[model samples]
Target: MNSMPKYLLMALALISLIACKTSQVSTTPSPAAGMFKVAILYPNGDDKTFDMDYYEKKHMPMVAGHLGSNLKFYEIDKGTAGRTPADKVPFVAIGYFYISDVAEYNKAIAQNRDAIIGDIKNYTNIQPVINISEIRQVVGNNTK
Candidate 1:
């Protein structure tokens, strides 16, 4: 059997592509009205002890209970390495909290501040540097 001309075949293919369209999947990010807050605590001096096990098992649970609905999610990142593997981690550990509101976060924190502070001694000697940040989703071709 004889095939159509190359130009005609190409035109038909283009038309078929345009006609046979599929439903597009929504790639919208999850709805999160609240901001994300992170507090990174750096060790004050060389002589310090951080009890990771206790922090994960005890302290975080207490914080979560107090936080309640205000707390959307929480994470802990232990400083294991720096830019170079040989280099020491700048901070001892970092705490990330996705909160519904700043005021709620503060209130929860205020109510349990003493207990939280008290627990710190059980873990590490270093007083960490704290930082709060807003959560922003980067919407671009690179992001899904």
Candidate 2:
């Protein structure tokens, strides 16, 4: 049987996730109920090299290009260690992209699904854990 490409599958899943409880875009980590996107990438087995440069320079730009305005503030976290120093990190990196609404973000990804999925190869070989979730600002800025 013919199966959809992995990236396409990931895109479809992301779209579905957004549709169910979808959107908010912000620079802060505050969870705004129905508006946030979080994508995490894990290392594919023993592969040690994760091209951080390409991810920042090439892959993300391609994603932003297609996502356009729907793409709000986003963050990338490169894992250095787990809860302790000895334990290895579960995932290599994480991406958090916020948008105005779920439906709009879903539409944006659906339209540029191919390009977005295809660009994954430029970064890592592992399949990322993509999740659409609500952003809740548990703690406000303490500096103020």
Best by TM-score: 1
Q: Tell me the tens digit of each residue's lDDT in model 2 across 44-83.
A: 3476557778887887767767667767767778877888
Per-residue alpha-carbon lDDT of candidate 1 for residues 1-144, written as tens digits (9 for 90 to 100): 245587789999988887676444656434253466757575534787888898889988888889898777778888877779887787778777777688888888899999988988887887867777776763546766
Residue 65 in model 1: shift from native, Å?
0.9
Stretches of candidate 2 above 4 Å error?
1-34, 141-144
Cα displacement (angstroms), candidate 1, residue 134, comes to 1.1
Against the true structure, whose lDDT is highest?
1
Relative to the true structure, how large is the alpha-carbon lDDT of every model?
0.76, 0.72
lDDT of 1 at 66: 91
CA error at residue 38 for candidate 2, angstroms: 3.0
Q: CA shift at 77, candidate 1, in angstroms?
A: 0.6
Error at 66, model 1, angstroms = 0.5
Runs of candidate 1 exceeding 4 Å displacement = 1-34, 139-144
